[model samples]
Target: MQNVLQYLPQLLGAAFKYTIPIAVISFVIGIVIALITALIRISNKRGVMLVVKAIFRFYVWIFRTTPLLVQLFIVYFGLPYLKIAGIAPDGIKLVPFTAGILTFSLNTGAYCSETIRAAIIAIPKGQWEAASTLGMTRRQALQRIILPQALRTSVPPLANSFISLVKDTSLAASITIIELFEVSQQIAAANFQPLLMYSLVALIYAVFCTVLTFIQGYLEKITSRYTIA
Candidate 1:
């Protein structure tokens, strides 16, 4: 009990410094990637775009189908060996933090792209037509009208994804990132109280996720208000 209290700050500190930051940064980047991918995949043009769409589809498929841990290992460990000649004779090598961010962003983006795409598709075709009738270009319709509605509908799922991402940041420990879970592991090793330390960490994660859940509810309420007649 005394030891746990003593080390509580350290555990929280790790979360503030590494865990939260990693998740926030990764999720932000992931959202951008997801929005772009979703937009591109749904675009009507089909010239060179066919090639681009296929590439994005394969990327999403590969990330969604593979284990995240394997993805981390590939980014952090395997990439260093793939020599790239002039681009990089020694291949691509990323620091632990960079590797974690890269993997998490891409993985989350792949999943969130599907979520966003579904949300966009859920918008009524009449909505698009309405925007067009207002003398709006497709780009203007998407930017000014379509995306706002999609965002409202997508908020819950996207928030859920963000919460899951917060928990998943613990996996950064596997690659020597020394995040929240790793901090707990280190303390447990020292105190020889693995059960207590693990439980404590889990509680922290639950707390963080609970806060996110509340935020999700709040957002859902706000977004749904205009729909309620």
Candidate 2:
């Protein structure tokens, strides 16, 4: 207990340093991949749409069905076994940070793809007709008219996903990345005060998620003005 209290600052600082990058990078890359996936899902070409849907569906099925911890293990541990023989070289394996970023990004992308696809589909047919009447091509209408509205519609869900990613970052610790929960675990193990350390970690996560909730509400209010519904 005394040791945990004494080292609180160091523990917290290390945790935040390790966790923030995972959350931010994952969210950004995930959103971009999701947007592209959504665009493909909504395209007029049947072949393109089918391919995109299959990719997204498979991604979502795999990630959602498997435990995230196992996924991280495969990325950090299993990949080395399948590396390109001696060409890949030793010590060039995925680092904890790389594993955190890659796994989180892929996991978030699976969910975000669905949210984005729904948003794009929800765009009003009249909006498309209006854009075409103005001499816009389908691609131009999607880019100029449909996507913006879909983005607004997607905001709340995207915010929720960001919040979830922020908390899930603790899973990175399982791969030896010293994220919040991992730091707390170390503190508790050293001091024999697991309850106190874990409680603090939980509190920190709750506060962060709470802030995200407020931001989501504010964005929803601002975007509501532009919403077709």
Candidate 3:
């Protein structure tokens, strides 16, 4: 306990340095991908719908089926093999950070797409009709009316995704990325105090996730005001 307290600042500082960028960038890009996939999942055109659905289905299948560590290894260390033979004579210089972002983003995108699709569908058809009557196109109605409501309904799930991503960032360490968990591992190895060091790591994650929960709750409260009864 005393040793953990002594090393808390160092562990936390390293953890923050590694986790924050991975979480934020992955969440943002993952949300964007999920939004596009959700739109495809809901679209009406046969050609557009078929292609998008196929793409997303394959994408989600591949990512969800594999362990995240395998994904990171392939992206960070395996891509430059036969896949990119002509593109560059040299192998890909896969950075750990880039690998971390790619893995986290793709992983989160699959789950969040379903969350987003459900949210959009949950919106009332009356809202769409109201928007059309007010001189809005389908796109406009989706942008101005349906999406806003969907966002409110989507908050809790989206928050869960973000929280998961935060913890998942620790997997970056497996690929030589010096994230919080990796730092904890190194400290534990040196001090031979695995239990104490990991407890601190868990505490840090809990604190961050708790803060996100509060923010999500507050946002949900605000968004509820605008939700159609």
- lDDT tens digits, residue span 88-186, model 1: 898899999999999999999999999999999999999999999999999999999999999999999999899999999998999999899999999
Candidate 1, residue 55: how far the Cα is off, in Å: 0.6
Clashes of each: 0, 0, 0
In candidate 3, what are the lDDT values of residues 98-159, reduced to their tens digit?
87888899889988998999999988889988999999987999898999889988999999
Best by lDDT: 1
| CA deviation > 4 Å runs, candidate 2 | 1-5, 46-53, 85-92, 227-229
lDDT of 2 by residue, 73-124 (tens): 9999887776465687553478889988999998888889889999988988
The top-ranked prediction according to TM-score is: 1
Clashing pairs in 1: none
lDDT of each: 0.95, 0.84, 0.87
